[model samples]
Target: MNFRLFSQLSSYHADIKRLIKIALPILLAQIAQNSMGLVDTIMAGRVSATDMAAISVGASIWLPLVLFGHGLLLALPPTVSYLNGSGQQHRIAHQIRQGIWIALASCIPLGILIYYSDFALRFMQMEPHMAHIAQDYLHAMLWGLPAYLLLMNFRCLNDGIAKTKPAMVITFLGLMLNIPLNYIFIYGKLGIPAFGAVGCGIATAIVNWSMCLMMIGYSYFNRQERKLQVFSQIIEKPNAATLKKLLQLGLPIAIALCCEVALFAITALLLSPLGANIVASHQIALNTSSLIFMFPMSIGMATTILVGQALGAGAPEKAKKLSYAALLLGLTLTVVTAFITIFYRYQIAAIFVTDEIVIGMAATLLFLAAIYQFSDTVQVVVGGVLRGYKDTKVILYITLFSYWVIGIPLGYVLARTDLLMPSIGAQGFWLAFVVSLTFAAVLLFYRMRKTQSLSDDVLMARLEKLK
Candidate 1:
């Protein structure tokens, strides 16, 4: 009995190591991408408060739209993973070509929305000068939209095959380029006129296009990728059926992402009237949570790739094992992060602010944030596993209900109204997050089990075919 337990522990450890190998590069790439945003904010703040606000405001708008595109293009990676596992390598180029077309088609409308995002700013009645700066930033970012989408497309292709290191290198290089580019354009270096915050947009656009080209070049030259000949079919006409399938699989994921993003966004708006200190504290805690979130999020992405590959190989049992290992691994990592957040909460908050009250309040919120990591890790990993099985509609349903129907309403009542006892301010929202995310995690786990049970038959059928 002890030996059996030891053997199971060994299996889990090996699977965890494999998942980490794929996840580490992805985590680094995500960090580098986020660092670019941090650079923009810090540099813009140095110029003026209004410039910094404009950059933040502009990012809040564009980032969600970017995530929408990202969600849609996410259909590609699992598809590529499946094809690669099924020994249908020849079909991957066609799949990738279709993905490119979808990206192009989606880019047109998203670009229009971004370019005219100033309308929303106008409606918000923002300060005229800051609004204008924000508008300019969005328009500048518009130029990079296509490159950004395509970069994601090919990056997904590489991720599907577990070739994540190249993306990490390329993205780090982009981050290196952004610092100087921002310096040049923001400060009027090398005889260029200073554009201030707008320069961040310009720099980001250049970096996006640069990274896109790099990934494309890598795909063309890398021996494994070269055989797929993704670039060779760059201009392949879109298939109506293929496009529909991609949309059907992708749009729900996009909407689900929007729902989750909107929850936090709306929460901030609701919390605005509470006072600047409250908002600042909330932002501090939220930012810290988001940074720590990268760890489990990377594991989730790896789960999607690994599980899809297993399923494609007609190994449902293997896919189930991988999913379980990934969940355990994600939970374990979050526990470590949570412990750090809890023990060093005051220190973490202090890094963001020197104000004693804000630091104390943010530290308190960080404790609540740490509590929610377990739920967050579970839901995210299960979401990734569901994507592997091409079952995304359930995720959309669950998040919409959990975040909108349950989390937000509960938070609003607890934070603002006396109906649920005296207002608790930001802590209420953190509690809501814990509740909603835990609700999501439970529902997702059941759904995953259901999927696993159903897939066993699929495995047997495939084996029969082979026989």
Candidate 2:
């Protein structure tokens, strides 16, 4: 019995090692991408509160729109993963073509929507100067929409093929470019006029195009990708069925993403009444937490690809093992990060802004943020696994229950203080966030288990048929 138990432990250890091999590079790449945004916010914060607010407001206007496109484009990775798993390389290319079409179709409406974001900010009660700065940023950034969507499609395709290293390399180069570009544009160095916050927008646009082109160039020149029939058929006619499938798969992700983003946007709007200091503090905490989240988020993305490919290859057991392995790895890493944040929360918050109130509030929120990290890691990894299984609808419903039904109500009661506790303010919201994520983690894991069980049954039945 001891030998058997040792064998089981060894198997589990091997699975985790495999997961790490697949997930670590993806995590690093995600961190690099996230750091770009963090650097932008930090640089903007250094200029002035007004500059920080401009970025916050600009993000409020831009992120939702960008995420909407991202959500729609998310359909590509899973589809490619599924096809690649089935050895359908030609179909992968066709899906890529369809994905490009979908991205283009969505960009027109999205561009128009984002273009008018400045006018929308006026209605949101932003100050004239702030609104102007935000408008300039939004308009400048809008130019990158096509490029951004294209890059996402390519990244997803590459990830589907289990090739994360190229994406990582491209993203790192983009980050390297972003700092100099931001410095040059924001400060008007190198004989350029200082564009301030607007410069961030321009720099972002350039990076988007550069990354997209670089990915395209790399895919074209690389022998591995070139050997795939899909690469050869880049200019093939679009298939309606393929488009429909992409849309079906992508729309829920888009809606789910939009809902979450809308929640943050609404929170920003609500906090606006509390004064700029409160909002600024909230943004600081939000930004910091978001950066930390990239660790789990990257693992989650890796989980989706790995699990999807496992399922596509008719290995439900392998998929299940991968999911658990990823979950364990994510939890371990997140716990370490949480400890770091807990011990140095104040010092970390100091990096963002100079305001004492902002720093104090952010520090308080960071503690709650630490508590949520475990739940966040679990939910994200499980969610990725579920996406791999094409069980996104269930996850979407779970998110609704956790975020809206439970989290928002609890936050309202705690933050506004009508019933349970006095106004704990933003910290109250963070506590609610922790609760919601915990519930989500439980539901997602349960669902993934059910799905895995079903998959196993199907596989057994298929094997019986073969006999």
Candidate 3:
């Protein structure tokens, strides 16, 4: 018994080291990607709280919608990873090609939704000037939608094959480029008209196009990509059957993600009427938490790759062990981040805006954000491992219930009505986040445990379907 326990511990230790190897690049890449939001908040806030609010509101409208498409494409990585693990590399190029079709098909509808975002703004009942700024911000981002979608497809391709560094390098370059572009567009330098908050969207659009082009170029030149031949038959007609399978896998993931993101987006909108100070404060707290969130999110994403690969290699037991290691690692990292958030809440809030009222409010909210980190990390990481098992529908169902039914309603009652207590405003939403995420974490952990207990014969049946 002692020897067996020691061996298991040794295996877990090795798995964690491997998980971090894959996760670190993904973490840096996500940080670089989300830092653009931080940049937008800081730069836009410099102009005025209203401008910051505009970016916040505009993001609320577009991001969830955009991520809806993004979530759909996320189905690609695990699929590719499974194929790679199972020695079906010959089929990868065709799947990637079909994925590109999904990306292109998605762009038009998502763009159309974002194009008419003024309706959403109006529904939010924001002041007209703030509404106009948000509308303009959405419009500017439309140009980048296609590029962003295509870039995600390639990024997923790379991640599936465990080649995360290329995206890290490219996104870092994009971030480097975005800063200067933000300055030029926001401040109207180099003969460009100053677009204020709207400029963030424009700079991001340009960066998206640039990153997409760079990724395409990289894929063409990448040695592994050449071997995979992902681009060989660029114009192959879309297979209806293949596309259907992708959608069946992808749609649930997309809806699940949207369900969660929309809760935040709607919360932003609900907070809009309270004033720019409150909305900007909410953005600051949310942004800080989001940046910190990259750590666990990366861990989860890496787990999807690792778990899928392990299972593909006909090692269900290894995949189960990998999930356990990932969850432990994620919770450990969350503890560190939560501590950082607690200690530096005020200073972190100050990084975004100078308003004393906003800073104080944001600091309070950051404390609440800290409270949810454990639950948040568990749920997200567990969700990733489940994806590797192709157990997606439970994720969709659980997230929908937790975020929409439990969290949102509870939050609205606390934030907007006197039914629960006096309205706590933005703090109520953050409080609800803790509750919903805890519920999700508990349920997802249960689901993962159930998956881990599947008999070898059952597990083999699951893997057989991947063929």
Candidate 4:
């Protein structure tokens, strides 16, 4: 018994080390991407409260679009992983080429939407100056949208093959670039006039394109990548059958992300009627928690790659073990983050805003956010595992029901009405957020288990021809 137990313990430790190898780079990359928004909000807040408000509103406009495309491209990595695991390296170049075509087709419509999205302000009735600044932020940020999305495909390609460090290096470079560019454009360091919130948009757009180029350059020159010739088919025509499958897998992911993003956004929007301080406070709490979320999100991403590769190699037991290891790691990290968030909520809140009212309000919100972290960790890890199995449709259905059917409506009632006892203002929305994510966590956990039970047979049948 002792020897057998020791063997299992050793196996767990090895699996964890392997997961960390992939997850650490991904964690840095996720942090690099989320920090751009943090820096943008902080720099904009430094200029003026109105500037900060403009940023909050503008983020609501652009985030869903960016994340929607991102979620869609997520379908590519698992596809590549399956091929790689099955030793079908020859197909990767073709699959990547198809992803590029899909990205181009998707980005054009989104680019037009974001460019014209400035008109959405007419419906919001925000202050004239804030509205104008927000509009400029959206339009100025447009050039980066296509690059941002196209980079996701490249990143996915690298991630599928477990070459994640290049993505980390490139994204960290973007973060380094984002700060100086923000300082120069936002504060008018040279001959340029101070653009305030608009400067963030300009800086983001530039850094985004740079990251995309760097990823492309890395993919082009890497010795191993050259072995696969991932870009050799760059000029190939879009294969309809391939494109359809990519979209079929990706669109549900896209819609699920849209629903999740909308839940957060609408909470911000609904709280807008409360006051500027309320909206600003909510953004700070959301941003901080989101930064903390990157750790688990990266773990989930790594889990998907590992799990998919294992299943593709016809090792269902290995995949299940990988998922278990990932879940344990994610939960452990969240516990630490939750402690810090709850204990030092004030110190964290003060970093984002100067107003005492906003600071106080945000401290309370962060406490609730700490409680929400566990649920967030479970759901994110499970979702990644499900994505590895290509079981995205169930995720969409569960997210829709959890956030929309129950959570959002509950937030509305708790925040605005006395029916759920006394109205709790902005904190009420966050309270609802906790409940929704918990619901998602429980359901996603069940679905992931179900997928595991059925994944082996399904994956074996599908790839039997390849073998």
lDDT of 1 by residue, 4-43 (tens): 9999889888989999999999999999999999999999
TM-score of each: 0.97, 0.91, 0.92, 0.93
Candidate 1 vs 4: which has more TM-score = 1
lDDT of 4 by residue, 398-461 (tens): 8998899888899989998999689988888899989999999999999888767775667678
lDDT of each: 0.90, 0.81, 0.90, 0.88
Off by over 4 Å in 4: 44-49, 187-196, 276-281, 353-360, 462-467
- Among all windows of 10 consecutive residues in model 1, the one with the lowest summed lDDT is 458-467
* Model 2 C-alpha lDDT per residue in residues 202-320, reported as the tens digit of each score: 99999999999999888788887787754665466777877776776788888888888887777766666667877777877787788888888888888888777776677778888
User: Comparing candidate 3 with candidate 4, which one achieves the higher lDDT?
Assistant: 3
Tell me the number of clashing residue pairs for each predicted model.
Answer: 0, 0, 0, 0
- Which segments of candidate 3 are over 4 A away from where they belong? 44-52, 125-130, 271-281, 344-364, 420-425
lDDT preference between candidates 2 and 4, better one: 4
Q: How accurate is candidate 3 locally (lDDT)?
A: 0.90
lDDT of 2: 0.81
Prediction 1 TM-score vs. true: 0.97
- Tell me the lDDT of model 2 at 436: 96
